[model samples]
Target: MRLLTQLVWVFTVLAILLAVVLLFTYDVIKVEWISFMEIQPSHRQMEDPLPVPARSIPIEGPVSIPGMLPPENPVEADEASIARGSELFEIHCRMCHGQTAEGNGPIAPFLANKPANLTSPIVQSKSDGSIFLTITNGVEGKMPPLNENLLVHDRWDLVNFIRTLTIED
Candidate 1:
């Protein structure tokens, strides 16, 4: 009887340990020794973000449908907006578009397709919306789309700054 009782206790302890291990293995329970490194699914920054439903319009405005006319610039070309655009342009565009916005940037000669002179008559003649679209989507095989790098308002501000370039010419 004594041996049998000891065996029963051992089995009970073993069963509890197995259950705990299974629970952790299956993620039924989570234990984090380091709080910053989350072990939960979909929580890490490197992990793919949660998916949005299809056809969901962004809260900011309508999506710029390709082949359709570019959206109007909602951001006003005020001093602050233009100033911000100038700063952003210098950081993101000056290397390729040049200090004068003349497409003779330091790297222009190295590229297979030279950057467009933003202040050229052809570019200056384009509608603000068209210029905005070009900035957002970029010219295929020539320029890269800046949509990912810049926010919508920032792009509009860039448009304003580009307008200033034409004015300077």
Candidate 2:
């Protein structure tokens, strides 16, 4: 009996020590036995981007310089264009601008700055290019820049949709 008790105690101590060593190895030591998933760069890495030559035209065509007369509205406000614009507006703009474009969207109250009323004269009076720029660059502290989320054509479509809002008022 005495020998059995001593064997049991020894085995228990050994098991606990093994467990402690494993925990330390995993949590504190962080031994990387197999580094199959290390943070090395792959072939798709963009470490050094090529610089564009001075006065090079943009690949997407000429971008209007801000403060110049708003670039001409290339996208016509035809029925098809308006329909596409309306769809894009609902997906991106409605969350903040509201269904009626009155700056009363469900999330509008939660925002730090209220969205501008799209149908208001101040907004409607601006040239289409100005509206397009606003959508592209966004108002500081008030709106977010949609240029990343929206394509240039989509922004133009949004401008066309905004025009319909003024017509309705």
Candidate 3:
């Protein structure tokens, strides 16, 4: 009878030790008991976010409607607007477009596709509305969209600043 009890105790102790080893090896075990967060839905880093609900305007207002022609540049290219655009370009574009808007920004060489030269006639000839759309939608696989980064007015300012790149540098 004593041997039977001792055998039972040994098996119970071994089972408990085995569980401890398993807990560490399978780290996710008993996570629900540890914290509710482990079981909740969570986003991973760099995860694509949920798409915006259809027909929803941004809090600032509609930038452009779907299936519409590229919207016109509503913001006039005044001195202040151009100045603001210059600042925005430096902050947002200088890394790739360069100080002279000549596609020689610090990171330009590192990119697989060279950044476009804003001073070039190709870019200069594009309509202000077209430039605005490029800034909004971005070049596929080349530039990332800035629509989320800049407000409508800010983008227009950036377009105006691009126009000024034509002067002799």
TM-score of each: 0.66, 0.66, 0.70
Q: Under the 3 Å rule for N, CA and C atoms, how many clashes does model 1 have?
A: 0
- lDDT on C-alpha atoms for all candidate structures: 0.85, 0.85, 0.88
Highest TM-score: which candidate? 3
How many angstroms is residue 58 displaced in model 2 relative to the true structure, after the best TM-score fit? 5.3
Pairs of residues clashing in candidate 1: none
Q: For candidate 1, lDDT tens digit of each residue in 36-136? A: 54655554566655565788765666648767877877888999999999999998899999999989899999999989888888898988889888887
Q: Sort all candidates by TM-score, best to worst.
A: 3, 1, 2
RMSD of each: 6.3, 6.8, 4.2
Writing each residue's lDDT as its tens digit, candidate 2 over 35-149 gives 7666554444555435557787656776587467879899889998899999998999999999999999989999999999999988999999889989987998889888767
**Top model number, lDDT:** 3
> How good is model 3 by TM-score?
0.70
Q: Which parts of model 2 are misplaced by more than 4 Å?
A: 1-58, 167-169
Candidate 2 local lDDT, residue 56: 75
Of candidates 3 and 2, the better by TM-score: 3
Which window of ten consecutive residues has the lowest lDDT sum in model 2? 41-50
